[model samples]
Each structure stands twice: as structure tokens, then as C-alpha cells.
Target chain A: MKILAVDDEPLVLRLLDATLNGLGYHNTSFATTAAQALHLLESSKSPYSCILLDIRMPGMDGIELCQQIRRMPAYKTTPIIMLTSLAEKEYIDESFASGATDYMNKPVDATELAARLRVARLIQNEYQRSAHLEELNRAQIEGFQPMAPFDFAEPVQIDDVSRVVNSRAMENYLRQLDRLGLFKIGVIGFQIRHAGSLHAANAPEEFYGILADVAESISENTREVNALIAYLGKGSFAAVVPRASQIDRRDLEAGIAATLYEFELADLVDSTSDIKVSVGTQINGSVFGNTPDKMIDLAVRSAQGMTESKPKALAARIWSLAG
Target chain B: MINSQETAASHLAAALAEIRARFINDLIPLINEMEYQRVAMTDPALAPEAFSSLQHASHKISGMAGSVGFPELGDHAARLDVTFTKLLRAPYDHAGVQAALDPLEAFLSLMEDILDEVL
Candidate 1:
């Protein structure tokens, strides 16, 4: 990839140029001043793939140079990586806001720089590939079935663990499904008595804690299962687990219910009523097959039925098929 | 290097870009530990030791940054170090250090802006 390396320090500029040339990338240019860098870009007919800039420069600093480069039509979308030495948070935020593609610390490592450049290339490639695929998909979808805008009911599974719940006492249940070992499964919207209230109040801190405690209890009981669990907001949570799988639906539901029951929310329970939950599971899912964006959409949809807001008749239904 | 528009606006951006790289690598990892130190330092019994540790860290950062030509960051760090130092020297001025935190956070936010600009 073609790169324009800018740094006020001669030693740094030499090091960068040498590193890139040594790494088999020969198309490199060096500029000690921001004005010189701008002159080079303005004069060159060929566009650079990336710009390596240092913040401190003699006349026009790197930041001004970046802005000038961005304003010019030739280098608008070209990625710029800033090289800095200070480890202050304010500096990081400003760099990103100013339109830098990435930042690297001084005493720069050649390998890390190359890796970062490669990642940037991959992202750019993926973006181009996706844009092309999207056009194709738009046409293909028209041939298959009518498309509908996606909608979600609620978030599911605050904690990162699996559970089985069979207690008929609760209408909504939340549990995680991780049989495939590909992605995390989180089921949310389960409360024995106050599920509706918690859901309505937007799952207050007390309710969220109850949800986390429930997942923690299940994880502690099973000891065999481990996961990272956190509430996703509302009466829901997301649990990242080892895998996803299809299992005995009732057993899975009951295990979740059992784990939830161990949590002591005496105050919340007393203030309202018993808390119960309904569980949902994904029948056929693989992390590798489904991208994170698609998987999250599916998981959120899978947990929909566990909400009381669904038509009473629909809320009472169970998954006949493992889907 | 202080042009009203370029340095005030873009120069700061450049300066921030320089610090951004370090923030991601060094500061983020220490966040959890900083919180721990804050808790320990704010405690009634261990306040002195906590204040001293904070002062030491801030002072070291202030000195190091000053040597490297980041007078703005160095000045802020020195102010913070002094505020903490006050707490150590005079127990009654415990609240003095809290006011310095905003500037630090603001500095952090400035760095974040640079990152957004570049990345």
C-alpha cells in the first residue's frame, strides 16, 4: 500500500520509511513538515492508501495537515493514522474526533503498525464487499418473499448462564440457549409475580439486580456452566455463553427457573408479588454461520413471547418447533 | 504554533492525537486500579496514604509531561498533584482535590475527540 509518512523528527521519519521498505512495501514518501506533506499530496497524481502523521510539526502541525488533506477532494476517505507519545485520555478522544483513522504510540513497533494497517485494509475490503452484496441481496429478496421492516419486543437473558424453568406459576420465563458452542443465548422477561410490573417500570435497578442474581444463582448451582452476564435494560439481560444448542425444552426452561428461584428479593417480592419467568430458546443457530448483528436480532426476537404485553392468547403459547 | 484557528482548534486536535495513542494503551488498563485507589484513598482511616499515592502519581506525570513539551497537560497534572498535596499537608482540605477532577476528565474528553477525528 502507498503511504505518506510525516514526522518532524528525522530519526522517526527514517525509521518509518525503513520499516515499510523492509516489510516489502516500497511505495513510501516522507515529509518533515505539514506544509511539505500537503505539497506532496497536492502535486502527486496518484493517491496514497494511508497517511502516517505525527502531531507535532514545525509550521502546520499534523492536526491542521489532516484537516487540510480531508478538505481536499483527493484524500477525503483515505485513512490517516496518528503517531503520538502521550498517554492521556483527552488526547485520544480529540484525535478520533478530528478524523484520524487510528492512533499509535511512539517508540513505535513495526509489527504492530503493519498489523493495524492490515486490519484497516480488511475493514475497507469488507465494507466494499458488503456494499456489493447488499445490492445483490436487495434484488434476490424481491424474488423470494416480500420484505418487512424488523421489529423487536424486548431484550432477553441478562446474565450469561443457562437455566431450565418448569414452574407453571410464572407466565414469562427467561433463559439462555448455548448448545451449538457458537454464540451466546439470553432469554429475558420472566418474573413469577411482578414480571409485568418490572417490565412496565423499565426494569428498575432492584429488578435488574434480581435478574443478575438469578443468573448468578444458576451459574453457582451448576458449577459446570460459566458465563458473563449483564442486564441489557428493561426486564431483560444478555448472557454470553460458550455455545448454542438444541436441548430438551422443558428441562432447559426448568433449569433457568430453578436458578432464578434461588435469588432472595424479599423486599421486591413483598412490595409486589411472587416473581416468575417464561423462557425462550433458539432451535437452529450457529455463531459461525450467523454474524453477530444477525444473531443478536434473532436472539432478541426469540425472547419475545416471554412478555405479558403479547396478546394474552399468544403469551400463553409455547414453541412447538425448536425454532 | 498558536494560530487562533489552527492551533486553538486543529492544533489542539494534533496535540490530542498525540496523547490518544497513549490513553488507549496506558490509561484504560489502569482505570480499574484507579477506582480501587480512589476508594482506598477516600476512606476515613487511610486518607493520608491514598492522598500521597495520588499526589505521587500526578506529580510524576506532571514532571514527565513538562519535560516532553506538553505544557498544557503538564500544567493540569501539576494542579491536580498540588490539590492532592494539599490534602496530605492539611487534612482539612480534603475536598480541594475533587475540583481538579473535572479538568482531568475534560482533558480525557479532548483526547477522545481527537480519536474520533482520526479514527
Candidate 2:
């Protein structure tokens, strides 16, 4: 895969060049400044598959550069990994917030770099598959009914949703936090009450619109706290927040319900929408036992285990009142 | 194929060694600038800028030194970087700053030792 690595240090760039070459990735380019990297990105004939960026630079630092790159239509979902020595929690938070796919601490180990590159390759392959499916969709639109590009159970990235990240990036952020001994975090999951029915009833675009609305509601509700939300397929979303932020399960559910109610009233959703969300109890990350993946799984399971009976009764009451 | 693989591995090793040697050579001037910054930190007016400069240099060293096989140096630089970052963030009088930077002497000595061994 074609790669672009941006770092101010000449030695680091040389080392990366040699390391990448040894690992059989010879089609790599280097830039010493964010400006230069932007120039290369704009002028290159072919799009780069992955990019490695340093967090600290003289002008227009890597976070800003990552944001700028995300603004470009072609690179919105490209795997931009922040490779730097700044292991501070703030930098990690900002890097992911600015649309970085992964963050790797410096003093690069070949084994670790190879593993990260492997993940990047997987992401790139997924993107390519999606692009191919989209082409198929366009071609079949005029002939037969177009197939949905994504499976109903697939966790597609929600674009243009503030504070919402792709599932992989969320996992990476959690893993990095775990590695850095920042275990004082909580995970909570939210699930649509009748997602299967909704998926069956609505068109693909409508279902996606529903998901985006849900994501925006969740993001708005959690705005007071530092939270990173990710949709984990099957109409479930997991959010990681600082443990200090006291999140009442009932309050979050109510907030989301109110927001969806507003969306329905404003015709932001279909007229028949009875969308409601149930929130799980917070799963706190402890120093000893829980892995990041395990935390996510347990939170999702918690949400899944919640009986939708109460939400259904409540929605019925709300509908009766509305009538 | 095995011979070719072996040749490629050896070539990479040689390239890494050359890069490490160049890194060590480049550190002499960096160490000199850091030492100058260390001296400059005694003045209250220059201390913040000096601390900022030291933090930047040490951060670079902390990141690169370990990758080139000098992990001890990397660890030391990382510690220094942390100290300088803390100093830069908080308002510190000259004496407090000097007290915090007491570890610099040993860190500089370590860099000099590495350079001497390399040269």
C-alpha cells in the first residue's frame, strides 16, 4: 500500500523508511512539515492508503493536519495514525477527536508497527469493498432494485456525527488508554428498542438516517462529559467516558427519548417513528481485570439484557397522550 | 530464496546500524544546545523558553533513541521531557526550576557517555 509519513525529525523519517522497506512496504513518501504533507496529498496522482503523522510539529501540528485531511473528500476515512512520543492523555484524546484512526507511541518497534499496518490494511480493504459495492448499487439502480451496500447487522461508520468515531478507532483509543494506565473510564451501551423491526420496515437510507439521528442525540446528551461514542453494529452504540462523570442510566434514556421525540415532531424522522432507546448501566474499567474489548462487550451485553418492556409501555403511553 | 531472505535481513541491519550511528553523531550538537538551555534556565526570564526548548529536544530524543537501540537514553530523555513539560506548564521561580532540573546534569553526562562510546 502507498504510505505517507510526516515527521520533522530526519532520523525518524529515515528509520521509518528503512523499517517500512524491510517490512515490504517500499512505496512510502516522507514530508517534514504539515504544509508539505498537504501539498503532497493534493498533488499526488493516486490516493495514499495510510498516513503516519507526528503529533508535535513546528507549524500546523498533526492534530490540525489530521482535521484538515479529514475535510478533504478523498481522505475522510483514510487510516491516519498518530505516531508520536506524546503519551499524555490529552494528546490521545485530541488526536482521536481530530479523526485519527490510531495513535502509536514513538520509539517505534518493528513488530508493533507491523501489527498496526496490518490493521490499516484491513481497514483499507473494507473501504475498497464498500466502494465496489457502492458502484454495484449505482449500476443496478436503473435495472433492478439496488442492493443495500451494507448488511443490516454491520456497524457502518456514521459520518458527520460529532464525537462519534468508527468502532475500530474507538477500540484503539480504549486500548491506548489501557496501555497508558488510564483505567478510570466507563463504558455504556445504548440500543434501539426495536431495531430489527425498524430495519425491516425502513429503507436502507432511512435506517441510516435513524442511526445518525440516534448518534446525534447520544452525542448531545453526553456533551457535558468527555465521551467517545461508537456504533457497534446491530443498532447498539458504546460510549467511553471519564469515570468521574456521573451518568444516570434513566437520565440518559430520557434525554435521548426527548431528542428523538423532537426529531419526530420536526419530521426529521418518518411519521410512523416510535423510536426509543434503552441505556445500559456504566461498566467501569478497573486496573486489574477488565480489558478494553471486554469492557465494550460487557457494556453491550448489559444494554442487550435490558428488557424493552418498560420502554414499550412508556412509548405506548406517550403515543396515547399524543393522540 | 533463503539466501535472498538472509541478504535482505543483513542489508536492513546494516542500514539500521548506519542510521543509529548517524543519530548518535547528531546528538552531540543537540546535547550542546540542551546544555546551553540548562544554563539559561538559571535566569527567570529565560527559564520558560529554556524549559520549552529542553522539553522539545528531550521529547525528540526520548522518541528516537530507543528505536535506534539506546533504550536507556530514551528512558532518561523521556523523564527529562516530563520534568521540563511540568516546569513549563506551572509558574516556577528560578530556584524551584533549578531544583526540578537537578537531574539534567546526570542526563547530560549519560548523553556524553553514549557519544564518547560511539565516537
Candidate 3:
């Protein structure tokens, strides 16, 4: 795969070059500055399949560079991995907010870099396959059964919403926080009350549009607390917020309902006029024994009202027995 | 065929060793430049720019040193970078600058020792 790596330090670039070459990635280009990187990206004959960016640079740091690349139409869904040494929360938050697909801390381990690149390659291949399927569908080929590119339960990326990230990126953010021992986050799940009915009633595209609308409403409602929202498919969404932020469940539900109501009135939603979302109780990550997947699962169950009493009662019983 | 694979692996190892050696050689002058900035940081008039330059160098070293087989140097550089960043946020003072100098000097000495051994 064609790759581009941008860093101001030539030694780091050389090291990366050697490492990447050792990993059998030879069609790689290097740039010492963001401007130069942009030039290389634009002037190249074919778009680079994967991009590696450094967070700190003299002009236009990696976060800003990632944002700029995302604005380009060709790279909207391309894999952009941030390779940085800065482990500050602010940088990590900004990197994902700017549309980075993955992040890796530097001192470039060959094994880890290879793994990240493998994931990037997989993402790129999937994009290509979807694009091909989309083209075939658009062409209206004879006797063709149009297939839905994504499953109803797959976490589809909701684009064009501020502070909204893909599910994978959200998980990675949480994992990074966990690694840093700074995982003081609250996970909340939101589920559309009638998502299944809506999905069955409308066309796939229409259902997707409704999902995007719900995602936008969730994003707008949680904008005040700086929540990172992701649509974890089947009409469910998850939001990660700083645990210290006070989130009243009633207010959030009301706010989202009001926004969806406004969208229905404006004809922005076709069949989602009766749709309501259930807001889950915030699940705070404990100082110990809380993984990202477990927190997310608990939040989703809470939204679904599956674990309202059983788990809590069971935990209480266990604690009493231990006592 | 196995011989070819072994040859390729050996070639990669040699290339990586060369790059690591070159990185150490290049780091010496950069560390010297950081020392110059560290000294310049004591001057009130030059303190802001000096601090900025020093932090930039330390950040680079912290990011790159470990990849080139100097993990301890990278840790020291990271500590120095954090110290400079914290000092930059507060008001500029000689006491803060003086306190930062010990780590900077220690980092410089560490780099020197590593270079002496590596070279």
C-alpha cells in the first residue's frame, strides 16, 4: 500500500522508513512538515492508502493536518493513524475529534506498528469493497439483488456531526485512557424506542438517514458536556463523557426528543415522527476492574432496561455474603 | 530459499543498526543546542523563546530516543519536557528556571554517557 508519513524530525523519519521497509512496506513517502505533506498528498497520482501523522510539528500540527485531510473528498473514510509521543488527554481528545482513525504512541515498536498497519489495510480493503458494491448498485445491473452494504447491528460511522467518532475510535480512546490510569469516564447508552419498527418500515437509505438524524440530535444535546457520541448500530448510540459532568437523564431525554420533534416538523425525518430515545443511567468507570467493553455493555443493558435490578441485587447479595 | 530469507533479515538488522548509530551521532549536537537554550533561559529577556526552543527539542528527543534504542534517555527527555511545559504555564521566574536546570543537566549527562558507550 502507498503510505505517507509526516514528521519534522528527519531521524524519526529515517527510523520509520527503515522500520516500514523492514515490514515490507516500501511504497512510502515522507514529508518533514504539514504543508509539504499536503503538497505530496495533492500532487500524487493516486491517493495514499494509509497515512501516519505526528502530533507535534512546527506549523499545522498533526491534529490540524488530519482535519485538513478529512476535508478533502477522497480521504473522508481513509485510515489516518496518529503516531505521536504526546500522551496528554487534550491531544488524544483533539486527535479523535479531528477525524483520526487510530492512534499509536511512538518509540515505534515494529510489532505494534505492523499490527496497526494491518488494521489500516483491512479498513482500506473494506472501503474498496463497499465502493465497488455501491457502484454496481448505482449502475442498475440486470437481475442483481441489491445488498445492504452494512448490517443492521454493525456500528455505522455517523459523519458530519461534531464530536462524533466511529465506534472503533471511541473504544481506542477509552482504552488509551485506561492505560494512562485516567479512565474517569461515564458511559451512557441511547436507544431509539421504535428503531426496529422504523427499520422494517423504511428503505435502508431512509433508515440510515434517520440514524444520522438521531446521531445529530444526540450530539447537539450533549454538546455542553463535551460528549463523544457513537452510533452502535441497531438504533443504539453510546456517549462517553467526563465522569464529573452532571448529566440529568430526564433533561437529556427531553432535549433529544425535542430535537427529533423539530426534525420531524421540518420534514427532515420521514417515518421517525413517533420515535423516542431511552437514555441509560450513566455507568462510571471504577478506579479498578472496569474495561471499556464491560462499561459499554453495562450502559447498553441499562438503556435496554435489562440490568435494572438483577445485576445490582446480585452484586449486593455477593457483597453481603463477603461481609 | 531459506538462505535468501536469512539474508534479508540480516540486511534489515544491519540497516536498523546503522540508523540507530546515526541517530545517536545526530543527537549529540541537538543536545548541545538544547543546553545552549537552557542557559539562555536564565536571561529574563530571552527566557520565553529559550524555553520554547528547549521544550521543542526535549519533546522531539522524548519521542525519538527510545525508538533508536535509548529508552532511558527518552524518559529523561520526557520528564524535562514536562518540567519545561509546566514552568512555561506559570509566570517566568529565576527560581522555576533554576529548578528545571538540574534535570536538563542530568539529561544532558545521560545522553553524553550513552553516546560515549555507543560510539
Candidate 4:
């Protein structure tokens, strides 16, 4: 596969070349500066399969190069890996923001580098295939018959929630995140005070509808926070915010609670126990015994604790607002 | 005669060995530079540049040292990077900076022995 390696450090470039060659990735090109890299990218006959780069450079660092490359129609779908020593969150965040697909900390291990390249290659191929299909015909994408809308029953779309994900899906996502050994995840659990009371609301759809309004409020306010909100059912919903270390869970909780509060969430859920956000900081697989059930149980317990702890918060606040 | 695969494995092992030694050798200068920067940080006038340099150096090590067979060094460097970053945000927190320096100082001392074995 054709790949480009960009770095200003001669030693680092040599190491990258040797490592990639050692892994049998021999058709690799080298450039010392972002300008040179851009020249090579523009001049190359075959579109590169992958690009590996360093963040810090003599002129126009890798991030800018990544952004410039992404802007190009030809390289839009190609995978870019930032192999750099600047492994701080700010640099990583900036790289991803500039449209980096994968980030590998350096000095990189040969095996790890090879594995990342393989993964990136697979992703790039998939992206290119999809892009090509769109080129063939816009109808290629829209031609499929849309799934029939639920006649009070269709499989839930776990992604964009007109309502938070259902109980089982939430648990599954939590389990998947934990199993991935991505420990810096935060979960903010919201316990609906009287889910049982919702039975009176015509059908389960109405209860879910109220939950959707609450979730929408959450999504709108915490848009910058960039978290996943899910419904764990049984009066519990959770927002799992990745990169928990960089984000202050308390501030996020307060922001969400404020939105829910100002919106007078009591009108939706009916019973007023101001959604006391139970923030879970440690999301390692080891935490909550590595099962979604335990995590859900803990969320339920937290919601129950909120009821006991702050019996009068929702009512008092709502009354004050009315008065 | 060894197979080509075995030869490649040893070659990789040898390359890694060189990197490990270079990594330890590199830490000495980086840690020395940071010591100088830390002293500069005591002077209110020089603190900002000193802290910035220290953070950059620590950030470099934190990003690569772990992969180069010095995971503890990476962890220590990461803490220093974080401490320097926090101090950068609040330069007047001399007491906080001093508290942060203790762990970094401990790690540098620990590294001297690791360097001996590695070198």
C-alpha cells in the first residue's frame, strides 16, 4: 500500500521508515516539511492509501497539513495517522478536530504501528467504496426502500435519539465501552422519580415521548460537551461522556440539570424530584463488576437515593417558579 | 543457521534495545533542562517561559517514553506535564507548584538508577 511519512526529525523519520519496512510496508514516501508533503500529495500519481505524520514540524505542522489534505477532494476519504511526541489531550483533540482518523503515540512500536495501519487501511477502503457508490448515483444511497415506521413497534435506533436509547441498548453500550479498556468515561445517571406513574399516560409511547423531550433538552444544551445520552428504563437515563478527564462531570451535570430545571422538567415526568444527576467517574470494566446490569442497578440505586435525599427540591423549585 | 523470521525478530529486538538506551540518555538532558526551568520558575519574572519549556519537555517524554520501555517514566512525566500545564494556567500558584515538584523530583532520582541499568 502507498503511504506517506512526514516528520522534521531525521532520527524519527529514519525510525518510522525502518519500522514500516520491517512490517513489510515498503511502498512508503517521505517528506520533512508540511509544504514538501503537500507537494508530494499533489504530485503523486496514485492516491496514497494511508498517511503517517508527526504533529510538530519546521513549517506548517502536521495538524494544518491534515486539515489541508482533508480539504482536498482526492484525499477526503484517505486515512491519516498522527504519529507524534506531542501526546497531550489538546494536541490529540486538535488532531481529531482537524479530521485525523487514528493517532499513535511515538516512538511507535512496530507491531502496534502495523496493526493501526491495517485498521486504517480497512476503514479507508470502506470509506472510498461508499464515496464511489455515491459518485455512481445519488440513487445508490436513496434507492433502498425505507423501513416502515413502527406501528407502535419498530426496532429502536440507538444512535440519534428522538428519545434516549432503551434500557438494554444503554447497558450494551456501557459494557462495550468498559470492555474496550477505555476507563476515562463518565456516566451521568438521571432517575425519573415516578416511572410507574407513567403507566397512566395512554401507552408506553407517551411516557417515552416525555423522556424524548427531556433528552432533547439535554442534547441541545450539552452539544459542546459531546456526550451520548441513553435511557436505562425503570426511571433511569444516563449520559456517558467520553474523555471524562478533560470534562468536568459536575459542570456537565449542572448544565444538564439547569436545562432540565429551566424547562420545568416536572411538566414532562409529572413528579418533581429535580433530576439529581448521579455522576459515575470510574467506568473501567472492573467498576460496576463489568456488567451493564450492575451499572443499571447502581443507576437505579442512585435515582432512589436522590428521591430520599432531596424530597422537596423539585416541588419547591417548581412552586417558586410559579409564584 | 537461524531462519529469516528469527533474524528479523532479533533485529527488531536490537533496534528496540538501542531506542531504550537512547530514551534513557535523552531523559537526562530533558530532566536537567526541566530542573533549570524549575529554578527559573521560582523567579516570578521568568516563571512563564520556564513553565512552558518544562511542560513541552515533559509532554515529549510522556508521549513516547512508555512505548520505549519506560512506562513508569512516562507516567511520572505525564504528571509533570499536567502539573506544568496547571501552573501555566495559574502562574501565581507557587505553593501548588512546589507540591507538584516533589513527585517529579522523586521520579528523576529514580530514573538515574534505571538509566544505569538501561545504559
State TM-scores per candidate: 0.34, 0.90, 0.87, 0.58
Chain A TM-scores of each predicted structure, in the order given, are 0.42, 0.89, 0.85, 0.51
Cα lDDT tens digits for candidate 3, A155-184: 766767898888877887788778778767
> How do these models rank on DockQ, best leading?
2, 3, 4, 1
Write the number of the candidate with greater DockQ, choosing between 1 and 4: 4
Q: Model 3 lDDT vs. the true structure?
A: 0.81
Q: Write the per-residue lDDT of candidate 4 for residues A1-323, one digit (tens) a residue.
A: 89999987655665676677668777989998999999999999988999988887756989899888976767755778888755455666466546566677765777878888887777666555554323422322344432222222221222234324434334434544454444455555565445555534435444445556567765654566565566554545666555444544444444545566666654324435443343333232345454656655564465456423233553454445446
Q: Please provide, for model 2 over A1-323, each residue's C-alpha lDDT reduced to its tens digit, 9 standing for 90 to 100.
A: 99999999888999999889888898999999999999999999999999999988998999999999987767877899999988888899889878999999989998999999999999888878786445433534344454464676778778778889889899999999998999889999999877888888787767878899999999989988968999888899999989878998866776777678778722223334578788898999998889999999999889888865355555554455446
Ranking of predictions according to lDDT:
2, 3, 4, 1
The candidate that wins on lDDT is: 2
CAPRI-style class, candidate 1:
incorrect
Give the number of colliding residue pairs in candidate 4: 0
* Candidate 3 residue pairs in clash (backbone atoms < 3 Å): none
Clashes of each: 79, 0, 0, 0
Alpha-carbon interface RMSD of model 2?
Answer: 0.9
- What is the per-residue lDDT of model 1 for residues A1-323, given as tens digits with 9 covering 90 to 100? 78899987654565565556545567989998988898899888887878889875657877777777866655544677877553343444344434555666555566877876885566445434544333323434344333221112222223223332111101111111222132344322222334456545542335445655665553443334333333333444333333443334344445554445445433222334434444445423355465443444454456555543232222223222223
The regions of model 2 sitting more than 4 angstroms off are: A131-149, A265-272, A308-323, B93-96
The candidate 1 chain A region of ten consecutive residues with least summed lDDT is A166-175
Off by over 4 Å in 3: A131-150, A265-272, A306-323, B93-95
> Which is the better candidate, 1 or 4, if ranked by TM-score?
4
Candidate 1 off by > 4 Å: A127-323, B1-119
lDDT of 4 at A198: 54
